[model samples]
Target: MSVTAVIRKNSYFDSVSLMSISTKANGIDGVDQAFVAMATEMNKAVLENLGLLSDELKAATTSDLMIVVVPSEGADGDELVPLVEELLVRKAPAAGSAEVSHRTIASALEEDADINLAVIAVNGAFAAREARKALDAGLNVMMFSDNVAVEDEIALKNLAHDNGLLMMGPDCGTAILNGVALCFGNAVRPGTVGIVAASGTGSQEVSVQVHALGGGVSQLIGTGGRDLSAEVGGVMMIDGIRALAADPGTEVIVLVSKPPAAETEAKVLAEVANAGKPVVVYFIGGSRDAVLAAGGHFAASSADAARQAVELSSAAASAPETLDAGQVDAVLARLTPEQVNVRGLFCGGTLCDESMYALLNDGHEVFSNIQKNPAFQIGAADSSRGHTFLDFGDDEFTNGRPHPMIDPSNRLARIVEEAKDPSVAALVMDFVLGFGAHEDPAGVTLPAIREAQRIAQEDGRHLEIIAYVLGTELDTPGLDAQRKALAGAGVTVTSSSTVTGEFARAIARKGAAA
Candidate 1:
């Protein structure tokens, strides 16, 4: 393989644009890997890590756009440069366009005094500076940039609090304000359920499930992943809960997170206790008694949270059509004696965690790269243990690449790999749909599912593919179409990740018995 680098001086593109360009480049016929980003220090470090850095790239300024492409063997590296340039040009607007984009937050506010929120996704080193400027201009902040220091996050949140404003994230990925879906959010119908979440996909899962169950969301606030940590003190979570409580449009409040520090949890529960509105809590590893004791209801998963919130809001809940015991047994009965394990490949970290928790609670010895249970941790990320689950969106897999949400290539390859293992009884997966996600996630993954099924059949084995789509009908790449595609591929598409997990566990349990 050959690596080629191109530097465009004085060129600028936003984070979303760069990610799009990179995804486009990687899709080229002969390209093995591609990275399109500004020459910021953090991006340069990423390039170095990917072994795509060059002397010329190192000399490029932060204002320059750097494009790197690695060609597969026997592919002409030089030929791919034009393709990258063409893709960038197609993705970006003309340089001479009359519609001008603002260079600073102050200018943007000056142009539109009604602008209430600033979505910042710059390099981590400069993310805090831009966020401060936005806050100073009296704008709420939704930070989509990662790599920011914890200290900076605390300072930003404190400043936002002092000004009576909401700071969604320093690494926040999902939120819905008023009716606009911001940064990595899905399009759900607007209604009475408002959410405050420290997990991105966790909130998306809940909001989508609510929409699917004939309920809708009024607002969804993201508190980033660290907001619930001891140092950050769940500042944003408490503030979000309070804001949603005060909004007349919101009737039921839901809080979602993986697990918070003990002290932080107590403070958050205290705020939830007096929110007046009915509250549902889904702290992944949290205690149910704690929520009940705090005058709030506890939900076991995102799906459960949505059901409880919809019920509290007086919306009719669409009963989930899960696999019954006999159906599960019938499916498991078809599995050969050698097929005794379930493999889950997930794009959302929280979904992976929930699946692991469900399987473990079902008395299955689940192993995962993101497992909180050390005893069940995978020996290596690339190696699958008994009933293994892998989070493809983990930093290790996305160090210099677009997230799996943007590109399902890695996950697709792993699905095929798992299918080759005769011991694998079931393959469970999740497809997340929303803004900033792949336009045709189901279409992109359907080919792999077909190939996996083909391989399993060739080996005289049956591979049951179970999938759950986290999205609403309103999201682009409509949820109904995605589900239909998966089902057409001979895969059992469930209504939610929670239901998918339960079904997979049942199949695995019966497989073990067989």
Candidate 2:
């Protein structure tokens, strides 16, 4: 599809629109275009990077940098500073302002209208209704909403498709265009690993793992949570694959989703048949018998997706073995039954899921939410209940990114807060590595660790610390030093999954002693 996107720097109204199908515009007047902002200076507080004319434009020469992204005449473009109320993904096929700061959606909606949009977008559900109105105005709807229902997503996607437009999502999280993330997404890794998934956390974890394995990514696309639902038709997932196949940079594709109904799976399999690139499909809990007719590979786990992605990036028929047994041993020992109770507090959903599964397998009764008599968050007093793996990323807390890998403060705070819980004994974290990631998660985590340790010591809790890092400082040089810094501070590290499992088992065995 030929895309024409425009970014206005001077206008106070900013928006993204998609122009689909042929349209008749007698003239600028007939087009019903209007930009009416009489403000002396409008504010732009963007949550995601939707691109200002240039990077220099991203900086605010005025006011507070606390604002996400703002509009100022500064050194950007000559067009009016577009008012983006809530910066979100821009797949407009047409352009509109986002991130309006405190401006009302109605005011933000009053943007230049010469070009018709096939879809209008806001970052997530906060803008769903407003986005729909723009869609009614012939915009091809692509929204960043994460909580949209399965049926709503299907209808919107279908309506857009019927009009020859594409609808992005109800819970769609991230999208990369020309290698830059237009949402709250990490920077592109830039390799042959192209991913299309029904899960945001799963996809993010896969991408992080791929990067850790010395592989980059061609593109990563999200198909929302219910894309494969029987009601939704799974069109986005299908189209995402087609788009990846078309991108020359992508040599291999990865598809991840929870199991769909049998029929939906069949349809997805049928669609996979035509793609020329080798694919690795992971349908969580999918049967081994399920196969992709086309030359596609199926993997049993997300980590396997990481392994396959590395294999695809290298031309060698054989995969590179970057395993370091030393690091592995360190991590495994921490999880050993003799360590301490290992509790996990994570921001990312997938990390929580993986940690829960791993800890459970290690023989710990993982309490996710404290409300269900789970050990972590039910009561202010209950948080102290030790021998728990708590995921702070559940809907109750996280405001934006679920994975603490992106924003460490909130998750770290949860970790420290949990450390104060008298019943707790140990803590575990995943040091996710990649671009747009905290320079050193362990570094960021160390202060919290020390505080937790200090509090534990004061309380006579004697908390043990262990971490499961996705990357090795050894492979990344200074990164190894960073890992060592944490180790030096008393946090043991494990190099790979095998070691993490061992450490967790140790924690369980140790917890039984407590």
Candidate 3:
């Protein structure tokens, strides 16, 4: 009998098991055997893990294309009828290898992304296949596309390691590598600080802190959102650190995340202890007890970690230094009345809010997560004339699509446009790149600064572009290159987002020198 399979619309799965295909009276063939085996494996929850389907409850809902897995040649018309019932959609294409299905999706995107960065969105077979292709191309791949087979992730990451590359997530939400902003928001400077984080937001906070201390990142690697799970293990984490240790540019290491299984934590910390660099560690809400036993220094707060990373990155001959809130207050106290409008643009959702939250005293107002959320997908403004904290995720610049990490056109353009605004004196930004981020962010970034300079010079307006970048990740497109690019632009680059905030505050209340 000829069997039919339906492909669902809006589906992100490109790896559908094609099963078998033949005519009637012939019985099962290779395609049939393969399809049946794939179906029998029965791990629908993988959809959720891969970020293909955000929820697990609906993994089995298939519909768009009608695929017929015929048993063999000829067969029976009666069997064909039964199998045909599974078919749907008049626009179906003939079923073939999974590779062909992926190309179909790619053709759809080619019109938009073409061969360049404007490519908008791709779901289903295309996003998956191209995601794999991107990994093969050695780009820092951060897939919100979840539930990928563990084996696939291992293979992807192993291949990346072999090529001296890094892969942040099969479910990685944030990464800052080579001073290029990816999926997350942060305002870090180009400095000696390096980070390998398991939590997306944790690295964001740390990098911001580093920038605040007049420091920056060499690279910031994200190892999926959960690297310490007994099931997920720390394979990527191990590969990431091993790569970082070999990097000549990274002088200091910072590890940040939530606590993991005791064994997993031990495995990660043991490596940190032996990394031969001063490691500043923060596993949020983790037992201080575990850190004490780690034999490495523990940071009680993100701010402390940032300060230490800066001190260590700078080749300080002593313990890291500190700039108290009082010192910060003192810096702010000198600001004149005209410079109260500090504008911050970031990619990390949590870091954006944290900066807003920190700066939000009496008169200060903030706008967190400004870009990705549907409400502000286009643009937004805070009626308040106070300080503003905005998030322009790699995704929010939907000139065509999301993924600010991979494409810098929108943010870079915004940098030039926003510089022209009358009220925008101090501009705050974050640069994150990794195995999962854009290939060479600095290549796209420097020109924007040059243009912003042209506009600033044209108007004779004193514009300050303050930024923090995270570049210390285990990848071939090293973060150091991006960091240096930003520095060469003569912009104020730091390592921590909070310090970037402070720098913005100084610029907003002060002027171009900040």
Output the number of the TM-score-best candidate: 1
Ranked by TM-score, the better of candidates 2 and 3 is 2
Arrange candidates by TM-score, highest first: which order? 1, 2, 3
lDDT leader: 1
Models 1 onward score TM values of: 0.94, 0.62, 0.44
Model 3, 138-168: lDDT tens digits are 4545565444666666666677667665666
Q: Against the hidden true structure, what lDDT does model 3 obtain?
A: 0.55
Please write out the lDDT profile of model 2 over residues 1-514, one tens digit for every residue.
1111233343332212210000111012222221211111121222222232233333433222211222232423112112221232334443566633334434444654543432234333335665556566666444654555565677666666566554667655555544655443454356778888876667766765676677777788777767887888688888888888888988888887756667777777777678887878887656556664444677756777778767866633334333455654554443333344567665455555555555555556666652233333352224534455555545445332223444465566667786776555567666655443455667767888888889877865456676765543323324467668778988866554334445555556556764
Going through the candidates in the order shown, the clash numbers are: 0, 71, 85
Model 1 lDDT on a 0 to 1 scale:
0.88
| Local error of candidate 2 at residue 300 (angstroms) | 3.3
- Per residue, candidate 1 scores C-alpha lDDT tens digits across 363-393 of 8788888877788766334578679999888
Clash pairs, model 1 backbone? none
> Which stretches of model 2 miss by more than 4 angstroms?
1-126, 129-142, 163-166, 229-233, 258-266, 291-295, 313-340, 360-365, 370-387, 399-409, 420-425, 431-444, 457-462, 468-488, 493-514
For model 2, the local distance difference test gives 0.55
